[model samples]
Target: MTSDTAATAATPAAAKSPRALARARRRHSAVRFWRAYRTHKAGLIGLGTLVVIALAALFAPLLVGADAQSVTDAPGEAMRAPTGEFPLGTDQFGRDLLALLVWGARISLTVGLLAAFLSVAIGTVVGITAGHFRGWYATVIMRVTDWFLVMPTLVLAIALASVMDRSLWTIVVAIGVTTWPTTARLVRAQTLAVESRPYIERAQALGGGHGHIMTRHVLPNVMPLVLAQTTLVISSAILTEATLAFLGLGDPTVVSWGGLLQDAREAGAVSAGDWWYLAPPGIAIAVVALAFTLCGRAVESVLNPRLGVTR
Candidate 1:
């Protein structure tokens, strides 16, 4: 067969095997994303730090050799400074500060991740639906999103948490629901841009269903932004959870970084100048928040260079 004939024959086989084509496309996109990602060194560092924090939180109990909830005074052990045995010292309640911190890390990170995922899921759906439909539906959705945008997120979350039972899941839901408007607006804007492209028009012309076009085309195109937004959401969610915990709205049963801070405050750690009691949790929050912010900025810069974000 001639070269042209061979090429035509392969084209039909290629079209017949969509899974192979899809795998190839995915691999290509992964490579492209990695290339873009490597250009941001700070982002890589932030990602590394984030990973370390996660691992530390996950293995807290094993590393500490004690349950965070365990109270051990053993005669005048309360509020002691760091020693050979207790690296982070003890709280006023005689719980190991290091153990509490480890457990707190787990809770804080879990809340951050779960809340961000929920927020992003809601935002992506609302955004894609509004942007793709573009009519009265879009108008209504946008208006609702705008209403959310106008509301004070922290205040709304505080109100929701105050009304609900204090639990980890409740706090997560409160933060997630309150924080989605920004992601929705961002996704909607990106969806509008993606939908106007020629490929989307061609897909529509080819009789692609709304579901097919959105899931296969528009979502992939806008995912980088969604991912970037999710990272930022995680940071905000963590902060929000901490704030709620500080106000005594945290799950009373669970130990979280915020709860530790609350415990310290109530115990007069600040006034007593007990750095051991006060510093670790505060530093943990700051470090984790900064890591997420750095990673988010890097992803945002790589995916949307038009925003003109610098390192």
Candidate 2:
């Protein structure tokens, strides 16, 4: 009896070892998204670059060891290329370009993230509402979205920004508002497809509430579209915000990459041979946007597969 009991215990332990090993293998598989993320190599590189940029942006203050608003007391002058201390060089005002660039990253990422999220959130709600509920409700929601689709995004954003007193929030909101139409249209299409599935029909037969059916079944089906759209929107929002900031439509109080461009342009840094003043911010915006575009496109192609794009 004792021997049989010990054998049973040993059998259970032996069985668990393979299960643990399988679980680890499963986890390892999930991390290799790049292996299947082909069809957009540039996008992958861009995505990777953005990740690095975001990390640096997040850690900028610690890296600089200085407050963003605090000016250096040193009698520093501007238009110089990179030195050991200020790798990116100083602007006309003698503020450390490295520090300002790092600080500016915070603004760029903040606008990118916050504006993207707001755009996604608003678009999702409008899309779902229009798709799941037909008749005049859908017509009204879609007609509003049409205005967004037709209007020139930058011009509309400028007009909106002009009214809001030029704060960071104004930039964020303007970007969010203009960018939502695409997401809404995508969501509405997805919802239309999902609402017709047999499972949804069964749920309706069972007297499930509209909220429950939408939340549980319809929403999950549309989520992939939402996630993929987020990457593209983040980069787009950042670029738009930067454009507004550069144009003097942005809040004058805030320091953004666009604001830097505006300063550099106003100072004639390019004509006067201050390439350092103009290069970093432009490159940063381009790199970040390219990264998102690549990564988003790659993931979308992989998931949808029928797009037939080559690796």
The numbered model that scores best in TM-score is 1
lDDT per residue as tens, model 1, 1-311: 69999999888767767788788889998899889888888898899999998898888868765455765533227899998778889999777787788888899999999999999999999999999999999999889999989999999999999999889999999999988988889888989999888988898899999999889998988898899999998999999999899889999888899998899999999999999998999999999999999999998998888876766
Q: How many backbone clashes does candidate 2 have?
A: 4
Clashing pairs in 1: none
Q: Estimate, for each residue in 1-311, the C-alpha lDDT of model 2 and write its tens digit.
A: 99999999898667777779778776875565556774477666877787788888788868875564455553256666788877888888777777788778889889888999999999999999899998999999999999999989889888889888778888889888888999999999999999988988999999998899879888878887898899889889989988998888887766789888998999899789888999999988887788788777777776677887555
Q: Whole-model lDDT, candidate 2? A: 0.84
Model 2 segments more than 4 A misplaced: 1-35, 38-44, 72-75
lDDT values, one for every candidate: 0.89, 0.84
CA error at residue 144 for candidate 2, angstroms: 1.4
